[model samples]
Target: MLRKIIHVDMDAFYASVEQLDFPELIGKPIAVGGDGARGVVAAASYEARKFGVRSAISGVQAKKNCPGLIFVKPRFERYKEISTQIRRIFYDYTDLVEPLALDEAFLDVSNNKIGCPSATLIAYEIRQRIYQELGLTASAGISINKFLAKIASDYNKPNGQKTIEPQEVEEFLEELEIKKFFGIGKKTADRMYHHGIFTGKDLKSKSIEFLIENFGKAGAEYYNLVRGIQDSPVRPNRTIKSLGTERTFDENLSSEIFLLEKLDGLVQELSLRLKKSNVSGKTVTLKIKYRDFVQQTRSKTLPYFMSDSELILDVVKGLLFQEELKDSVRLIGVTISSLNTEIKKLPFVIQLEFDF
Candidate 1:
């Protein structure tokens, strides 16, 4: 039997929630993030996007794009409260719910608790409840597999839904751009474009061997992806691999004095999370996103597993100053894994949320 998958994505989640809570901010250009010269945009409202304001861009740039843009800080606790409400609604239909982030999730309804034979109806009902109960709008995509469902969900904007029937898979993929396919990033797409593989139809014309030759290990996977043969299952009780928080700077920083100073507050945040979850690890990973958005990670595994924030900070400092950066950094994040604490089966783990 085909896996009836539904992908639910919220519309401009964080910014919309702000608008809902503060009526005066409605219909205005606003963003959620620090407004300082050293801060980066966390989320942007639809109105702000018109002026070229985007997440991860510096606040200075965002303001330059829209002089009247209002900046607000992120409130993850409040967003988590609303996300729980959304999950309760999903549980009414099926337990096969896999949350991708705080604002979007995938649901398998092939054998749903509600016994709804039509995936379209289930998606419609889910969207209506979110708006009526939470004062939020959601877009849904329904299909026979997870990959197709995710693409379909983005077809309409704000509060719309779309579904792809089994029979329409071939025609649907043929017309889609290679960039739009899941797992195909900008770097890969650029390489494919150079080879004249611009769309699904162009990809379909190539033999599997030819694709493997160009893409290496990913070639076999791409061969199946273009034909819409995705069979990855929806994982409800997904294990938490690692937990971390990150900060984006308004300006790229390359100096060690400034970078080390930034680590103090970052360590404090990581400490809080470690204490809250009661997890200790020997592996500490440091992540850096450069000016051009290229990211790199360096990690260290200590002899003992400890959740000491100061110790983690000490290790990362060595990694950072050990090598000169190729470019100034726009963002920094830290994570600890290989944990000694118990692994809990969780329905979801909050990640960076976005409408796209």
Candidate 2:
């Protein structure tokens, strides 16, 4: 049986949330990030996107793109509150909801609580409910599987929906641009283009053996994707693999003393995150990025799991001085892996407050 999958993505989530709370920001080009020299945009409102402003770009560049662009500091706790509300709505229909981020998720409604057979209708209702309850708009794509559904969601974005019937999957993919396919990044698309693979049809023409020889293990994945054969399930409780935090300085720091000061703060933030998640790990990795953009990492595995700030800081300090400074540092990060968490299963219970 073809599994019914729906991928719902919030329209400019962070920026929209800011606009919703601050009436003056509505319809204005706003970015959810710092406006400082070293600040990067976490999200950009649709109005800001019109001016070529986008997420991950420097705040300076965003301002250059649109002089009227407004920058608001991120309120992560508020975003999480809204995200929880959204997930409650998803659980109303199905327990098989896989959240990719705070803004997007994949729902497996082939066997749903409401016994709704039409995935498209379920998606429409979900989007409507979100708008009605939270004043936030969402876009959705409905199809036979996760990959196609995710791709289709982007077809009609920002408060819209699309459906790709199982029968239409073949023709739709054939005409789809290779770069638009899920899991294919810009670099990979460029490599495919060099081999004259411009569209799904072109990708389908290559033999699996030829694909494997050129692209390694990913070649087989491409072959199956072009054939509409993705079978990954929508897992509601995804295991937490690792937790981390990082900081990028406005000015590069060359002194070891300054680097230690920065590490102190990072360790504290990471510890809070670990405690909130209720997980600890045995491995701590320190990441260093120099002013020239070259990156390096130093890792140490402890005999026991730890999440305390002091323990993490001790490991980071040792790593920081383990090697001499290659150049002035611009960014530093701490990551804890090899977690004690094996399988985290969140209890699935429908929220009763929502009428629908």
Candidate 3:
């Protein structure tokens, strides 16, 4: 039986939350992030987006795009509080919910508690409850699987929902622009264009071997995606593979002394995270992003798992000097992998009957 999947994404989540809390900021251009020259826009309101303001772009650029744009600092705790509330509403329908982030999630309602036969209606009810209970709007996509549901969710933005019936999947994909496909970024789209792959129809015409030869493993994924063959399940309690943190400097740092000082703070942060998660790893990786946007990583594996700040710092210090700096650094991060935490698989029970 075909599974029922719904993808729900809050509209401009961070910015919308700010506006919802401060009515004075409603309907105006606002960005959720620092206003400093070095600050990056964490999220942009729909009004700000109209002026070319977007997330990850420098605050300076966002300000230049919209002179009237207001910058607000991020309140992660508040966001988490709201996210928890939203998840409660999701639980009313099904337990098979996979959170992509604080603002979006995938719900498998094939065997929902509410016994709602129609996934479309479940999505609609979910959106309505969110607006009524939290004063926040959401968009939803309902389809037979996660991939199609995710794409359909974006079809109607801000406060709308779309349903892609299984019968419509083929034509919907065929005419769709290659660039609009999820996971196909600008660079990948450009490469596809060079090979005369301009739409889903074009992508479907290529043999799997041809795609694999050109794009490596990702090419096979693209081939399968175009044919709507994705079978990855929506895992509710996804395993914690790795945990780390990074900082992007306002100004580039060229000296090893300064880099080492930065590494100390990162180690402290990673250690705290490890303690919080109750997990330790044997591998420590040092990530360096140069001023030119080039990234490099150096990793070292130890004989035993370690989560102590001093030991992690020692490992980081060694990895830092193992390779000479190729250029001034713009960002640096630390990651711990090969975790000692065991993964417990969730039992899956087959649905004997479907209401639909």
Candidate 4:
């Protein structure tokens, strides 16, 4: 059976919101991020893109490219509110919606409540409503699976919609650039290019065994993607196994005091989420990413499940203190896992099941 999937991506989300709030900046080149010398671009407006400005680029460098670029700091709270509004719009169609980030999500409208057979039409309507109601523009891609739909969404971007039927998958993929394929990061794309796999057509010609030998686990995925054999589902909403919070700064943190302040914010956010879900966690995980993009995580399991913000922060701070990383920190996150979903009747150090 051909499952209908839709990938909806907001256009220049943070920058677009800024333009929406400040009408005067609608047509101007806008960069939503810190404007400090060491700051990085969080999101760039379409106007900025003409001058080769982009997210993650240094603010100093962005200014060099687009001399008149306007820099605005990110308003995460506003973004989250807008994201909630968008997610509400998605639930109007189907509950089978999987949010990828603040600005993007996948909807499985194959068996929709609206009784709409055409997922493409549903995507168009959703985009229209989002623009009319939220004053935002969105691009949507409709296809038989998540991978193809995600790719199709970018094909016609900035308030555009693109559809890929089952029959056209082969021809559609043939012209696709390797870099445009999902999960193919800069490092993977470089290796693929060296191995003569620069395009979807080139990837299609490679044998599964040859790809597996070169790319390991993802090599088999490359084989499936080239043939448009994506079987991944639009995951239905389920109980969250973990709750976490992360922040990637515009500038790297070199001071321990600054890092501790950031960790305080993360702990507060995690505490609120954990309390809201009524979940206590036994394991606390700290993730750190260096300025050079290298990532590492440290986790500690407690003797008992805890929902205390102070203890969580203390454990994370202890882990950070032990690590002797001299590199400036680019990102930091805290996560709570290993939940204690006890039913009260179950004894400690035992697993019990009773059929009702």
* Top candidate when judged by TM-score against the true structure: 3
Query: Model 4 clash pairs?
Result: none
- For lDDT, candidate 1 versus 2, the one ahead is 2
lDDT of 2 by residue, 1-62 (tens): 57888999999999999999999899999998767755667789999999999876667888
Model 4: lDDT to the true structure: 0.84
Candidate 2 residue 40 C-alpha distance from true site, Å: 1.5
TM-score (C-alpha) between model 4 and the true structure: 0.72
Q: Which ten residues in a row have the lowest lDDT in candidate 3?
A: 347-356
For all predicted structures, in order, the TM-scores are: 0.78, 0.77, 0.79, 0.72
Q: Write down the worst ten-residue block by lDDT for model 2.
A: 347-356
Instruction: Point out where model 4 deviates above 4 Å.
Output: 238-356
Better of 1 and 4 by lDDT: 4
Task: Name every residue pair that clashes in candidate 2.
Answer: none
How should the candidates be ordered by TM-score, best one leading?
A: 3, 1, 2, 4
RMSD of 1: 7.2
Worst 10 residues of 4 by lDDT: 347-356
Candidate order (lDDT):
2, 3, 4, 1
lDDT of each: 0.84, 0.87, 0.87, 0.84
| Model 2 stretches astray by more than 4 angstroms | 243-297, 300-321, 324-342, 345-356
Q: Tens-digit lDDT track for model 3 on 218-317?
A: 9999988887778777788766788888888989999889998777767765764565345789999999999999999999999999887789989999
